[model samples]
Target chain A: MSFHDREFKKPDFNRISDVIWEVPTSFKQGMRVPAQVFTTKKLLGEMDAHVFDQITNVATLPGIVRAAMCMPDGHSGYGFPIGGVAAMDIENGGVISPGGIGFDINCGMRLLRTDLTWKDVEPKLKQLVNLLYDRVPAGVGSAAFDDAAGFAKLSHGQFREMISSGAEWCVEKGYGWKEDLAVTEEEGNAEGADESRVSDKAVKRGLGQVGTLGSGNHYLEIQVVKKENIFDEEYAKKLGIFPGQVVVMFHCGSRGFGHQVATDYLQLFLSVMESKYGIKILDRELACAPFTSKEGQDYFAAMKCGINFSFANRQMIAHRIREAFAQIFGKDAEALGMRQIYDVAHNTAKLEEYEVDGKKKKLLIHRKGATRSLGPGNPNIPKAYRDIGQPVIIGGSMETGSYLLVGTKGAEEQTFGSTAHGAGRTMSRTRAIREIVGNTRDMPRDKARAIERRKVEELVINPMIKKGIYVKSVSYSGLAEEAGFAYKDIDEVIDATAKADISKPVVRLIPVGNVKG
Target chain B: MTMSYHFVEDVSLADVAFEASGKDLKELFESAGLAVTNTMVRNLASVHTKVTKTVDVEGSDVENLMFNFLQEFVFLKDAERLLFGKIKIDEISEIACKATLYGEKLDSKRHDLSVDVKAITYHMFRVERTREGWQAFVVLDV
Candidate 1:
């Protein structure tokens, strides 16, 4: 049956609290565990029914522990909804699925703070945005660097090293500061990356697209923090966040390299899922293999390579942003205090030790469209922020504001220490395009183009300009698809997480400029 | 018979979904390829058939065959920067197929690129024969 025809009843959910809901294993025939969703009643009511279907599908997967969980910002995705999290027991026939980690292997976000205030950047905001647009190669099929010579300098050997070493490779190559690696997740390097297992095609795609901000929801924003928006004054001050402070936040993934890896593995897993592993799944997109099998290990090793590629990718972008700042401010990046607060991967499956049934067991945790929210006093967090917790960067739409949250111990107990990544989409891209741009399905090509151009100006461009935000994009239609109205309210999404006690808000940021691909 | 394809809205929050139809296996593959290309660029006529690449893919079933066939185009677009607006199936079978893709290198000035499709997803992906023809539903991660 088509997914749209699927209907869910309110009785399917067993309310655990005001913000938490559960779909018991008895709700579905094949489910091995319950599905827990962290969201308010209003958000839950507004969520698409497919989200529940997909998450319930995840609960039925083999070797799932506790429950298949969805964060506050959960929305429908392929096999598992975005913002879905599940942990599998490695010792008990646990399986690894590429869909759980998403196509973009290490799709993530990074936030860099600066000492400058909005006053210092307000006058040059236009020039700064233009310069950044020129320096960073963005848009469809964008390459590594703007200059031909710079792109050519990246040789095959260097590319291999970069994937193996991740952000450290960037630092070694003098692309970023040495201290930058410390604040990154896993020191910006995930171990057990076997580059030999990576297909040649994936490597070729990785070579030229290391430093690009690819299109469709990926962006870089310049933001300001107002004193009233600081919810936790002591914690914000400790993180060097002050009133009127300017920060740079960018969201992207491992680019085509990660996509190719996921593509290759999904194909391979489809063959092994039923034939070799004797595993049955509700959907082909949830294709997987036993973690101990050769196919699974090979995919894990190659996935590590993809993860490293993303780390290196963001590191290079951070370096370029620093360069743009230096050019605009007439000072070195260090002197401008462009310090990286943290870099976290939202799409990944990491092997971690979590308490399960009063025993500390190592589980393979898959977090898609979710961020690692390690609470205060967690030894995994960086030394500088151990007392405060890991910083979770939630990138809202260009028009709406973003949030900076900290992990909580409650998250560790409930969600294996994970939180929502961003304000999930409330509508589909097709709906957004049809709402903003005239419906072009029946119109002639030229007429449709004219209508789209006019509608884009009236809908996306004008609204953003009125909000005092400068946007530089390669495709107007693409920008229109990501308009603020397309996503759920960031404030509401953040509040859900806070009410659920998964994360605590620290500061809110107002956007001043945005660069989209 | 001429290949036919049209975009269809699905429930994905971060993807573009569509359905393609054809009279037979060959036309089905061709229509699916065009659907993916059209998702990337607005106008299919603007992409001239200046270049050709022979694509050979093997799958154990019709669904796998369709998945591999469409994914080859995404790889070509990203790796070679080529966008194919037309396809000719040289041969086809349940387990394997070969085709020649006709398109040109992507030129930003000429092609009005719309969205960057990252990969073809297997979520609710299907290829089936109907009373009149064959059909497939595909979701693209953008």
Candidate 2:
């Protein structure tokens, strides 16, 4: 039967039972193949139709294999929705677009589990939040601290080390430990990043941004793990998540450097997209080139720079968080038992071997705001985590809880082993401000105006302004876009996901405090 | 047409929008261009015209349509010191726009603004019809 009966934007289809929907090639014009979505009817209703458009766009890209996939938290983005995933045949005509990678670049999230539980932090939530805010710079132009330290405003000749070493570079630079890389995605690095392709401006942005929790979707959150956190806790502990324990979670990426990189390439891609390949684009943001094309190869190389820069950036932030804890507790970082659980990036086009037509072939997979949830026993996963699969850290807003999930056995065939990034934006930022000021009263208007002013200033503004990165998106309901109340209850979303058997949930993280920027 | 933007600080802050209608698209676009420039420099009178350039922008949609057109003007002002004093829209297509903006080279000492508008941003951008005709809203890069 056709999807017409569904009565949705792109009528939802069936892929893997009812949990997954495949938008077959016949569903849309210029669709090279089907676009698969991992969402139920209830969750699908809440998603943005723009996400489907992005998925369809990915499907039409050269060298794409299997299908363009969207996780449960799918939302609109520049070229690819935040929770979109697609793999391409590298040898064929796999293409790469910086927009597909996103502006933050490797803005991934990491979760750290400590021995202390919420019982340890319930009364001290205010103290801990105040302490965290004071220690970690939130909001814009926060890297003044980077300059305070001996680190140069910008680094050189070390960008490559960041690519290969990932978190290790920060560790070597005295920002972190060598062991941290083990808990990071791809050891906190994507291999084959060519730094020479990166522009000097991008490098400048990366220099001070490392170790700084930049403004927007970039936040440090305190979450309490729940028992029925969504799926299971024993599996959560295997992923280093525990019930009632305190965990530090945040998401950011290669900041200005990454944005500039994407910006530079977007402009460059537009010039070459038509002349070199004769490609016509529906959206300027969707500009892309074949992976083998000189322009495409150059962009991939540059994007890897962004990925590596992000790995280093998160590593530095982790180090700073550890420092804050040590300072407050008057104990060594090791004594506090702040150990790296896992860090996973939600963006990038990686060359991986996946089954296409039931045969494994190397494909360039572009995952924007979609975490790579490799199934169990994958060699890429560490020996410790190989049995449980890689840890997927899903960050939700301060109001809605975050989740820790493990890859399911069937995820490989379903989504190339991928999962959602966070609670997809439920409304636009402009709408959020306007909704909060429904009456346009002087009080809320003043606050909104302040936020707007601070945001434009690019200074150490309010943490909420930083939410601009994960700007809320909605259609009919404007109030739902205002705050956490707008997002699907993270707990309920997790339940639907687990019940649907997309990924087995582990730890439920109820946020107590937040530091946005 | 003349335009003015006043950011009054009541409890906090807000960019109060104000515009004057014009006879043509050139005047309309020029007034909007001045609104953006006003955010930076104290006045545009100091930045004289050493050179001028024509910018053509294309977008199938009306929103991008106005955004790209304004951006080129902003780009010339920032990068080339071409402050647009007058504008003349030759043709406006469904997706493309052709315009002639008159301005001269930039002098940092003269057009001394606190935040340098590096480029125009695509964030929270809009363009719509007004009682007079069409209007565009944009945030300048600083």
State which docking tier applies to candidate 2: incorrect
Q: Which stretches of candidate 2 lie over 4 Å from their true place?
A: A1-16, A155-165, A228-233, A439-482, B1-142
Interface RMSD of 2: 12.9
> What are the models' TM-scores?
0.97, 0.76
**Docking band of candidate 1:** medium
Error of 1 at B139 (Å): 0.7
lDDT of 2 by residue, A345-425 (tens): 987778778787878898787888788878788888888888887788888765566878877656766777777778776
Q: What DockQ, between 0 and 1, does each candidate earn? A: 0.66, 0.08
Please tell me what DockQ candidate 2 reaches.
0.08
Worst 10 residues of 2 chain A by lDDT: A470-479
- All candidates: TM-score of chain A: 0.97, 0.87
